[model samples]
Target: MLKTMHRPFHVSPWHLTLACGLFKLLLAAAAFALPLSQVDDLPRLVGLLLLAGGFSELLLSWTGRHSWVGRITFGSGALTVVLGALFIGGPWKGLYPLGPFVTVWFLLRALLSIDVAFQSRLTPMANWIWLLLRGFVDLALGLLLLAGAPLAMLAIVVFGEVREFVTLFSATLAVSFAIAGGGLVAIALTQRHYHRSDPFMIAS
Candidate 1:
Protein backbone atom coordinates (compact mmCIF):
# COMPACT_ATOMS: atom_id res chain seq x y z
CA MET A 1 0.00 0.00 0.00
CA LEU A 2 1.23 3.48 -0.84
CA LYS A 3 1.22 6.07 1.92
CA THR A 4 -0.36 9.48 1.37
CA MET A 5 0.96 12.55 3.12
CA HIS A 6 -0.70 15.85 3.89
CA ARG A 7 0.91 19.19 3.13
CA PRO A 8 0.91 22.20 5.39
CA PHE A 9 -1.48 25.02 4.66
CA HIS A 10 0.33 28.01 3.20
CA VAL A 11 -0.60 31.63 2.86
CA SER A 12 -3.38 32.12 0.36
CA PRO A 13 -3.67 34.54 -2.54
CA TRP A 14 -6.17 36.59 -0.58
CA HIS A 15 -3.57 37.24 2.08
CA LEU A 16 -1.08 38.40 -0.50
CA THR A 17 -3.71 40.60 -2.08
CA LEU A 18 -4.51 42.28 1.20
CA ALA A 19 -0.85 42.81 1.98
CA CYS A 20 -0.17 44.35 -1.43
CA GLY A 21 -3.26 46.53 -1.10
CA LEU A 22 -2.16 47.87 2.26
CA PHE A 23 1.34 48.59 0.98
CA LYS A 24 -0.02 50.51 -2.01
CA LEU A 25 -2.39 52.46 0.18
CA LEU A 26 0.44 53.49 2.42
CA LEU A 27 2.46 54.64 -0.57
CA ALA A 28 -0.49 56.66 -1.88
CA ALA A 29 -0.99 58.29 1.47
CA ALA A 30 2.67 59.21 1.63
CA ALA A 31 2.52 60.78 -1.81
CA PHE A 32 -0.49 62.81 -0.82
CA ALA A 33 1.28 64.08 2.25
CA LEU A 34 4.27 65.35 0.25
CA PRO A 35 4.35 69.12 -0.08
CA LEU A 36 3.37 70.43 -3.47
CA SER A 37 6.55 72.49 -3.93
CA GLN A 38 8.71 69.44 -3.54
CA VAL A 39 7.03 67.69 -6.43
CA ASP A 40 9.80 68.64 -8.84
CA ASP A 41 12.18 66.44 -6.91
CA LEU A 42 9.93 63.44 -7.57
CA PRO A 43 11.95 62.29 -10.54
CA ARG A 44 15.23 62.16 -8.66
CA LEU A 45 13.56 60.56 -5.68
CA VAL A 46 11.95 57.97 -7.88
CA GLY A 47 15.27 57.14 -9.46
CA LEU A 48 16.91 56.61 -6.11
CA LEU A 49 14.02 54.50 -4.89
CA LEU A 50 14.08 52.42 -8.04
CA LEU A 51 17.75 51.79 -7.58
CA ALA A 52 17.21 50.44 -4.10
CA GLY A 53 14.07 48.56 -5.03
CA GLY A 54 15.73 46.95 -8.03
CA PHE A 55 18.66 45.72 -6.01
CA SER A 56 16.43 44.22 -3.33
CA GLU A 57 14.15 42.66 -5.90
CA LEU A 58 17.11 41.13 -7.69
CA LEU A 59 18.30 39.53 -4.49
CA LEU A 60 14.86 38.11 -3.76
CA SER A 61 14.40 36.77 -7.27
CA TRP A 62 17.81 35.13 -7.36
CA THR A 63 17.33 33.46 -4.02
CA GLY A 64 13.82 32.16 -4.67
CA ARG A 65 12.98 29.46 -7.24
CA HIS A 66 9.27 29.82 -7.66
CA SER A 67 8.55 30.24 -11.35
CA TRP A 68 8.94 33.19 -13.65
CA VAL A 69 8.81 35.66 -10.76
CA GLY A 70 12.38 34.99 -9.78
CA ARG A 71 13.81 35.36 -13.23
CA ILE A 72 11.51 38.17 -14.32
CA THR A 73 11.83 40.11 -11.10
CA PHE A 74 15.57 39.74 -11.24
CA GLY A 75 15.72 41.03 -14.78
CA SER A 76 13.34 43.90 -14.09
CA GLY A 77 15.29 44.95 -11.02
CA ALA A 78 18.56 44.92 -12.88
CA LEU A 79 17.12 47.06 -15.66
CA THR A 80 15.62 49.56 -13.28
CA VAL A 81 18.83 49.85 -11.35
CA VAL A 82 20.90 50.40 -14.47
CA LEU A 83 18.54 52.97 -15.94
CA GLY A 84 18.11 54.76 -12.69
CA ALA A 85 21.85 54.91 -12.16
CA LEU A 86 22.32 56.41 -15.60
CA PHE A 87 19.64 59.03 -15.08
CA ILE A 88 21.01 60.10 -11.76
CA GLY A 89 24.68 59.84 -12.69
CA GLY A 90 24.62 61.62 -16.00
CA PRO A 91 24.70 65.37 -16.45
CA TRP A 92 21.39 67.10 -16.99
CA LYS A 93 20.39 66.64 -20.64
CA GLY A 94 17.20 68.35 -21.70
CA LEU A 95 16.36 65.54 -24.12
CA TYR A 96 16.72 62.82 -21.49
CA PRO A 97 13.86 64.17 -19.46
CA LEU A 98 12.91 62.43 -16.25
CA GLY A 99 9.25 62.43 -17.24
CA PRO A 100 9.70 60.41 -20.38
CA PHE A 101 12.09 58.00 -18.74
CA VAL A 102 9.71 57.41 -15.88
CA THR A 103 6.83 56.97 -18.28
CA VAL A 104 8.70 54.34 -20.23
CA TRP A 105 9.76 52.58 -17.07
CA PHE A 106 6.21 52.35 -15.83
CA LEU A 107 4.91 51.10 -19.14
CA LEU A 108 7.57 48.47 -19.30
CA ARG A 109 6.90 47.48 -15.73
CA ALA A 110 3.19 47.12 -16.41
CA LEU A 111 3.76 44.94 -19.42
CA LEU A 112 6.17 42.80 -17.45
CA SER A 113 3.59 42.50 -14.71
CA ILE A 114 1.31 40.70 -17.12
CA ASP A 115 3.78 37.85 -16.98
CA VAL A 116 3.79 38.03 -13.22
CA ALA A 117 0.02 37.84 -13.13
CA PHE A 118 -0.18 34.73 -15.25
CA GLN A 119 2.86 32.92 -13.93
CA SER A 120 2.60 29.72 -11.82
CA ARG A 121 -1.17 29.95 -11.86
CA LEU A 122 -3.66 32.38 -13.35
CA THR A 123 -3.92 35.54 -11.30
CA PRO A 124 -7.34 36.76 -10.30
CA MET A 125 -9.07 39.40 -12.38
CA ALA A 126 -8.82 41.78 -9.46
CA ASN A 127 -5.05 41.45 -9.49
CA TRP A 128 -4.93 42.37 -13.13
CA ILE A 129 -7.08 45.40 -12.38
CA TRP A 130 -4.67 46.43 -9.66
CA LEU A 131 -1.69 46.14 -11.98
CA LEU A 132 -3.45 48.25 -14.59
CA LEU A 133 -4.25 50.89 -12.00
CA ARG A 134 -0.63 51.04 -10.90
CA GLY A 135 0.48 51.48 -14.49
CA PHE A 136 -1.98 54.35 -14.91
CA VAL A 137 -0.72 56.07 -11.81
CA ASP A 138 2.88 55.75 -12.96
CA LEU A 139 2.02 57.16 -16.37
CA ALA A 140 0.07 60.04 -14.89
CA LEU A 141 2.78 60.93 -12.45
CA GLY A 142 5.37 60.89 -15.19
CA LEU A 143 3.27 63.20 -17.35
CA LEU A 144 2.64 65.55 -14.46
CA LEU A 145 6.32 65.74 -13.69
CA LEU A 146 7.17 66.47 -17.31
CA ALA A 147 4.56 69.19 -17.75
CA GLY A 148 5.94 71.00 -14.69
CA ALA A 149 2.51 72.35 -13.89
CA PRO A 150 1.93 70.75 -10.50
CA LEU A 151 5.40 71.61 -9.22
CA ALA A 152 5.06 75.22 -10.32
CA MET A 153 1.76 75.55 -8.57
CA LEU A 154 3.14 73.95 -5.48
CA ALA A 155 6.15 76.20 -5.43
CA ILE A 156 3.95 79.26 -5.77
CA VAL A 157 1.69 78.06 -2.99
CA VAL A 158 4.55 77.33 -0.63
CA PHE A 159 6.47 80.53 -1.41
CA GLY A 160 9.81 78.71 -1.87
CA GLU A 161 10.45 77.02 1.45
CA VAL A 162 12.98 74.83 -0.29
CA ARG A 163 14.59 73.19 2.73
CA GLU A 164 11.36 72.23 4.42
CA PHE A 165 9.94 70.94 1.14
CA VAL A 166 13.00 68.81 0.47
CA THR A 167 12.96 67.36 3.96
CA LEU A 168 9.31 66.43 3.82
CA PHE A 169 9.63 64.93 0.38
CA SER A 170 12.57 62.80 1.43
CA ALA A 171 10.75 61.60 4.53
CA THR A 172 7.66 60.61 2.62
CA LEU A 173 9.72 58.75 0.05
CA ALA A 174 11.55 56.86 2.77
CA VAL A 175 8.28 55.77 4.30
CA SER A 176 6.88 54.67 0.97
CA PHE A 177 9.96 52.60 0.24
CA ALA A 178 9.83 51.00 3.66
CA ILE A 179 6.28 49.86 3.09
CA ALA A 180 6.96 48.65 -0.43
CA GLY A 181 10.07 46.74 0.60
CA GLY A 182 8.28 45.14 3.51
CA GLY A 183 5.44 43.99 1.25
CA LEU A 184 7.83 42.51 -1.27
CA VAL A 185 9.73 40.67 1.45
CA ALA A 186 6.52 39.24 2.82
CA ILE A 187 5.39 38.03 -0.59
CA ALA A 188 8.80 36.51 -1.21
CA LEU A 189 8.57 34.62 2.06
CA THR A 190 5.19 33.29 1.07
CA GLN A 191 6.55 32.16 -2.27
CA ARG A 192 9.50 30.46 -0.62
CA HIS A 193 7.11 28.55 1.59
CA TYR A 194 5.22 27.29 -1.41
CA HIS A 195 8.36 26.43 -3.33
CA ARG A 196 9.78 24.45 -0.43
CA SER A 197 6.67 22.33 -0.18
CA ASP A 198 6.71 18.62 -1.08
CA PRO A 199 6.50 17.93 -4.81
CA PHE A 200 3.95 15.17 -4.28
CA MET A 201 1.25 17.48 -2.96
CA ILE A 202 -0.40 20.53 -4.48
CA ALA A 203 0.23 22.68 -1.38
CA SER A 204 3.91 21.85 -1.67
Candidate 2:
Protein backbone atom coordinates (compact mmCIF):
# COMPACT_ATOMS: atom_id res chain seq x y z
CA MET A 1 0.00 0.00 0.00
CA LEU A 2 1.14 3.54 -0.67
CA LYS A 3 1.88 5.65 2.37
CA THR A 4 1.25 9.34 2.19
CA MET A 5 4.23 11.57 2.88
CA HIS A 6 5.46 15.12 2.31
CA ARG A 7 8.04 14.23 -0.34
CA PRO A 8 8.95 11.40 -2.61
CA PHE A 9 11.62 11.47 -5.34
CA HIS A 10 12.02 15.23 -5.61
CA VAL A 11 9.95 15.57 -8.77
CA SER A 12 9.17 19.00 -10.24
CA PRO A 13 5.93 20.91 -10.67
CA TRP A 14 6.35 21.19 -14.44
CA HIS A 15 5.88 17.45 -14.85
CA LEU A 16 2.59 17.53 -13.06
CA THR A 17 1.54 20.48 -15.17
CA LEU A 18 2.34 18.51 -18.26
CA ALA A 19 0.25 15.52 -17.19
CA CYS A 20 -2.70 17.72 -16.38
CA GLY A 21 -2.40 19.43 -19.74
CA LEU A 22 -2.32 16.14 -21.65
CA PHE A 23 -5.44 14.82 -20.01
CA LYS A 24 -7.22 18.03 -20.84
CA LEU A 25 -6.15 17.84 -24.42
CA LEU A 26 -7.47 14.33 -24.75
CA LEU A 27 -10.77 15.39 -23.25
CA ALA A 28 -11.05 18.41 -25.54
CA ALA A 29 -10.37 16.31 -28.60
CA ALA A 30 -12.97 13.78 -27.56
CA ALA A 31 -15.53 16.52 -26.91
CA PHE A 32 -14.77 18.59 -29.96
CA ALA A 33 -15.06 15.64 -32.29
CA LEU A 34 -18.63 15.07 -31.25
CA PRO A 35 -21.65 16.60 -32.96
CA LEU A 36 -22.87 18.27 -29.81
CA SER A 37 -25.14 21.29 -30.11
CA GLN A 38 -25.83 22.98 -26.79
CA VAL A 39 -23.17 23.35 -24.13
CA ASP A 40 -25.48 22.13 -21.38
CA ASP A 41 -25.04 18.48 -22.30
CA LEU A 42 -21.29 18.53 -21.84
CA PRO A 43 -21.22 18.35 -18.05
CA ARG A 44 -22.94 15.01 -17.91
CA LEU A 45 -20.35 13.47 -20.19
CA VAL A 46 -17.41 15.20 -18.60
CA GLY A 47 -18.60 14.40 -15.10
CA LEU A 48 -18.88 10.74 -15.90
CA LEU A 49 -15.36 10.72 -17.34
CA LEU A 50 -14.00 12.51 -14.28
CA LEU A 51 -15.75 10.04 -12.03
CA ALA A 52 -13.93 7.22 -13.80
CA GLY A 53 -10.58 8.98 -13.91
CA GLY A 54 -10.87 9.99 -10.26
CA PHE A 55 -11.59 6.42 -9.27
CA SER A 56 -8.36 5.42 -10.98
CA GLU A 57 -6.42 8.16 -9.26
CA LEU A 58 -7.90 7.13 -5.95
CA LEU A 59 -6.57 3.64 -6.47
CA LEU A 60 -3.18 4.89 -7.51
CA SER A 61 -3.10 7.14 -4.46
CA TRP A 62 -3.84 4.15 -2.27
CA THR A 63 -1.03 2.11 -3.74
CA GLY A 64 1.67 4.60 -4.78
CA ARG A 65 1.79 6.98 -1.83
CA HIS A 66 4.94 6.02 0.00
CA SER A 67 5.66 9.74 -0.38
CA TRP A 68 4.21 13.23 -0.72
CA VAL A 69 3.55 12.57 -4.37
CA GLY A 70 1.04 9.88 -3.50
CA ARG A 71 -0.79 12.17 -1.11
CA ILE A 72 -1.19 14.88 -3.70
CA THR A 73 -2.34 12.46 -6.35
CA PHE A 74 -4.92 10.87 -4.09
CA GLY A 75 -6.17 14.19 -2.79
CA SER A 76 -6.51 15.61 -6.27
CA GLY A 77 -8.26 12.48 -7.50
CA ALA A 78 -10.74 12.55 -4.65
CA LEU A 79 -11.51 16.17 -5.27
CA THR A 80 -12.02 15.48 -8.93
CA VAL A 81 -14.53 12.73 -8.22
CA VAL A 82 -16.46 14.94 -5.83
CA LEU A 83 -16.54 17.87 -8.23
CA GLY A 84 -17.45 15.57 -11.09
CA ALA A 85 -20.37 14.14 -9.17
CA LEU A 86 -21.66 17.64 -8.45
CA PHE A 87 -21.43 18.49 -12.13
CA ILE A 88 -23.19 15.29 -13.11
CA GLY A 89 -26.03 15.97 -10.71
CA GLY A 90 -27.04 19.09 -12.61
CA PRO A 91 -27.36 21.47 -9.70
CA TRP A 92 -28.97 24.41 -11.50
CA LYS A 93 -30.83 25.18 -14.67
CA GLY A 94 -28.20 26.14 -17.19
CA LEU A 95 -26.01 27.49 -14.43
CA TYR A 96 -22.86 27.03 -16.48
CA PRO A 97 -22.00 26.80 -20.11
CA LEU A 98 -20.96 23.27 -20.94
CA GLY A 99 -18.32 24.32 -23.47
CA PRO A 100 -16.57 26.81 -21.19
CA PHE A 101 -16.78 24.62 -18.13
CA VAL A 102 -15.33 21.63 -19.98
CA THR A 103 -12.59 23.77 -21.43
CA VAL A 104 -11.66 25.10 -18.01
CA TRP A 105 -11.79 21.66 -16.45
CA PHE A 106 -9.41 20.30 -19.07
CA LEU A 107 -7.04 23.19 -18.58
CA LEU A 108 -7.00 22.64 -14.84
CA ARG A 109 -6.48 18.92 -15.23
CA ALA A 110 -3.59 19.60 -17.57
CA LEU A 111 -1.97 21.80 -14.95
CA LEU A 112 -2.46 19.14 -12.32
CA SER A 113 -0.91 16.49 -14.56
CA ILE A 114 2.15 18.65 -15.09
CA ASP A 115 2.59 18.81 -11.36
CA VAL A 116 2.20 15.06 -11.07
CA ALA A 117 4.73 14.38 -13.77
CA PHE A 118 7.38 16.49 -12.08
CA GLN A 119 6.79 15.08 -8.62
CA SER A 120 6.56 11.39 -9.47
CA ARG A 121 10.13 11.10 -10.75
CA LEU A 122 8.94 8.56 -13.25
CA THR A 123 10.56 9.19 -16.59
CA PRO A 124 10.60 8.11 -20.20
CA MET A 125 10.99 11.54 -21.73
CA ALA A 126 7.99 10.63 -23.82
CA ASN A 127 5.74 11.15 -20.83
CA TRP A 128 6.99 14.68 -20.37
CA ILE A 129 6.69 15.40 -24.06
CA TRP A 130 3.16 14.02 -24.12
CA LEU A 131 2.23 16.17 -21.16
CA LEU A 132 3.60 19.30 -22.78
CA LEU A 133 1.71 18.59 -25.96
CA ARG A 134 -1.46 17.96 -24.04
CA GLY A 135 -1.11 21.22 -22.12
CA PHE A 136 -0.62 23.25 -25.26
CA VAL A 137 -3.60 21.57 -26.90
CA ASP A 138 -5.81 22.19 -23.90
CA LEU A 139 -4.74 25.85 -23.75
CA ALA A 140 -5.50 26.19 -27.42
CA LEU A 141 -8.90 24.60 -27.01
CA GLY A 142 -9.73 26.84 -24.08
CA LEU A 143 -8.80 29.88 -26.10
CA LEU A 144 -10.90 28.65 -28.97
CA LEU A 145 -13.89 28.10 -26.74
CA LEU A 146 -13.53 31.60 -25.38
CA ALA A 147 -13.19 33.09 -28.81
CA GLY A 148 -15.83 30.96 -30.51
CA ALA A 149 -18.77 31.71 -28.29
CA PRO A 150 -20.48 33.81 -30.94
CA LEU A 151 -19.70 31.22 -33.55
CA ALA A 152 -21.19 28.45 -31.45
CA MET A 153 -24.31 30.54 -31.04
CA LEU A 154 -24.40 31.06 -34.73
CA ALA A 155 -24.11 27.30 -35.35
CA ILE A 156 -27.01 26.73 -33.05
CA VAL A 157 -29.06 29.18 -35.03
CA VAL A 158 -28.06 27.70 -38.33
CA PHE A 159 -28.94 24.22 -37.26
CA GLY A 160 -32.28 25.36 -35.87
CA GLU A 161 -33.87 24.69 -39.23
CA VAL A 162 -33.48 20.97 -39.73
CA ARG A 163 -34.60 18.09 -37.54
CA GLU A 164 -31.63 16.09 -38.79
CA PHE A 165 -29.23 18.44 -37.07
CA VAL A 166 -31.08 18.09 -33.79
CA THR A 167 -31.10 14.33 -34.15
CA LEU A 168 -27.42 14.32 -34.93
CA PHE A 169 -26.81 16.49 -31.91
CA SER A 170 -28.63 14.05 -29.67
CA ALA A 171 -26.67 11.16 -31.14
CA THR A 172 -23.49 13.08 -30.50
CA LEU A 173 -24.39 13.52 -26.86
CA ALA A 174 -25.14 9.83 -26.50
CA VAL A 175 -21.78 8.97 -28.00
CA SER A 176 -20.06 11.43 -25.74
CA PHE A 177 -21.56 9.79 -22.68
CA ALA A 178 -20.42 6.39 -23.91
CA ILE A 179 -16.91 7.60 -24.60
CA ALA A 180 -16.62 9.38 -21.27
CA GLY A 181 -17.92 6.36 -19.44
CA GLY A 182 -15.41 4.18 -21.21
CA GLY A 183 -12.61 6.56 -20.29
CA LEU A 184 -13.62 6.38 -16.65
CA VAL A 185 -13.64 2.63 -16.82
CA ALA A 186 -10.19 2.63 -18.35
CA ILE A 187 -8.89 4.89 -15.58
CA ALA A 188 -10.41 2.60 -13.01
CA LEU A 189 -8.56 -0.28 -14.56
CA THR A 190 -5.33 1.64 -14.44
CA GLN A 191 -5.91 2.32 -10.77
CA ARG A 192 -6.53 -1.34 -10.15
CA HIS A 193 -3.28 -2.17 -11.86
CA TYR A 194 -1.44 0.23 -9.60
CA HIS A 195 -3.23 -1.05 -6.54
CA ARG A 196 -2.71 -4.80 -6.76
CA SER A 197 -0.96 -5.38 -10.05
CA ASP A 198 -3.87 -7.64 -10.81
CA PRO A 199 -5.23 -7.76 -14.33
CA PHE A 200 -8.63 -8.77 -13.03
CA MET A 201 -9.16 -5.78 -10.75
CA ILE A 202 -10.68 -3.85 -13.61
CA ALA A 203 -13.70 -6.05 -14.26
CA SER A 204 -16.06 -3.38 -13.01
Best by TM-score: 1
lDDT of residue 151 for candidate 2: 60
Please identify model 1 stretches exceeding 4 Å from their true place: 1-45, 65-67, 93-96, 122-204
Query: Which residue segments of model 2 deviate by more than 4 Å?
Result: 1-43, 91-96, 118-126, 157-204
Compose the digit string of candidate 1's lDDT tens values, residues 28-68.
Answer: 45544445434455555555655766665565455433544
- Judging by lDDT against the true structure, name the best candidate: 2
Worst 10 residues of 1 by lDDT: 120-129
lDDT of 2 at 117: 54
Per candidate, the number of residue pairs that clash is 0, 21
